[model samples]
Target: MLKHSQIWRAIDRLAESKGLSPSGLARRAGLDSTTFNKSKRTTREGKPRWPSTESIAKILQATNTSLAEFTALVEGDGIGRPAPQTLPLIGFAQAGQAGYFDDAGWPVGAGWDEIRTPEVTDPHAYALEVSGDSMQPVYRDGDILVVAPDEAPRRGDRVVVRTMEGEVMVKELLRLSEKRVELKSLNPVHDDRSLAREQVEWIARVLWVSQ
Candidate 1:
C-alpha cells in the first residue's frame, strides 16, 4: 500500500526530475499552482491526506509520463529520466491561419518549427508559442505550450480550442457536453465562453508549458 508520505514525496521527486517546482508542475498539469503545496497535503487537524488520482493523472499526462514510470520513481527514490522528443511548433498567430493544420487539428503542410521536449506520449504532440503579453502573468510571450491533439479534454484541463471561424485560444475547460462546451478564461479580464459544439473546430489538451 502506498502511504500518504510516499505519494507526496513522489510528486516532489517527479517535479525535480522534470526541472520544475511543485507549483510549476501543477501549472503544467493545468491545475491550480497550490495543488501540490505542502500545506495542502494534510488537514488542519493533521490527519493523513492523500493526493487525488485525478490530480496524479493530470500530472502524468502533462509530463508525458506513464503510471508505471511514476511508480518506479516512488519505489526507487526518483531515479531515471526519459529521453527528449522533438515536436512540431508554431506561433499562435500562425496557428489561426489555414495550411498550418489539417481538419482534425494535426500539424500539416510545412513552415512548422520544432522544439525538443521530454517523453510526450502523444505522437501528435505540438507546441504553440505564446505571441505577446496579452495573456499576461499566466502565459508570457515566447512561452512554449506543448499540446496533445489526440488527448481527450476533461473538465479542469487547460485546452487549446479552435473555432470553426478560425479563431484559436487557450482556456481551461469548464464543462463539456454533446451540445456545447464551457471555457474559463485564463485572464480574468476576459469573459468566460460558452460555445455550441458546432462552432468548435477542434479541442486539444495542454500537456506542458516550457517557459
Candidate 2:
C-alpha cells in the first residue's frame, strides 16, 4: 500500500540527496518553484494534496534518479539510500568570524544550518555556501562546498584556509613547506597569495561542490 506521507517523505529525501531544497528541486525539474512547497502539499482546509505522477517523473529525470530507486525510498526499502549523516552549513562570509569553529575547525555554536549529503570520509566534514564574486568562474554565489577538515590537502587540491587574523579563503594548494604555503586563485583576475605556516589557523580540503 502506497501511503501519501511516505511518498512525500521520499520526495523530501530525494531533494536532500541532491543537496537542494524542495523548491530547488522543483526549479531543477522545470516546474514552478512552489510546486513541492509545504503549503502546496495541503489545501486551505488542511487536506492532503498528492503529487502528480508527471511531477514525480520530471523530478526523477532532472535528478537522474531511477524509478526503482525512488520506489525503494517510498517503500522504505533503503535502495540507493542517502547518507545518514547531516553536516553543518555556514556561509563563507560567516566562516571567517570567530566562535563559529573550535580549535580543530569543527563547527561550533549557533547560527549554523544543516544539510544531508553523501557519506564523507571525514567525520568533521562541513558545508559552506559560496558568497560574492571572489571565487567566481569556479564557484559562484549560492554554490555549496563540502569541506573535510580531517583530510590533509595535497598539492593541486582545492582547499579552504583560515588565518589567525580571522581571514578565510578558498584556493588551490600550489605548494606547502614548513615556512609557508602557496595558494593559487581560481579566477585569473586574482593574484596568488602566500601565507606563513604559523599564520594559518587551519587548512581543510574541499571534497565536493554542489552548484
Instruction: Provide C-alpha RMSD values for all models, in order.
Output: 12.7, 18.0
Q: Please give the lDDT score at residue 186 for candidate 2.
A: 91
C-alpha TM-scores of all predictions: 0.61, 0.60
**Model 2 misplacement above 4 A:** 1-84
Superposed Cα deviation of residue 14, candidate 1 (Å): 31
The residue-by-residue lDDT of candidate 2 on 1-211, one tens digit each, is 8765667767877886788777899999999998976546545332457899999999999999999999977765554344347888999989999899876566789999999887753445799999999998999999999997645567899999999899999999988776788999998899999988778887778998989
Per-residue alpha-carbon lDDT of model 1 for 131-179, expressed as tens digits?
Answer: 9776767899999999976455668989999999999999998987767
In angstroms, the error of model 1 at 86 is 0.5
Worst 10 residues of 2 by lDDT: 38-47
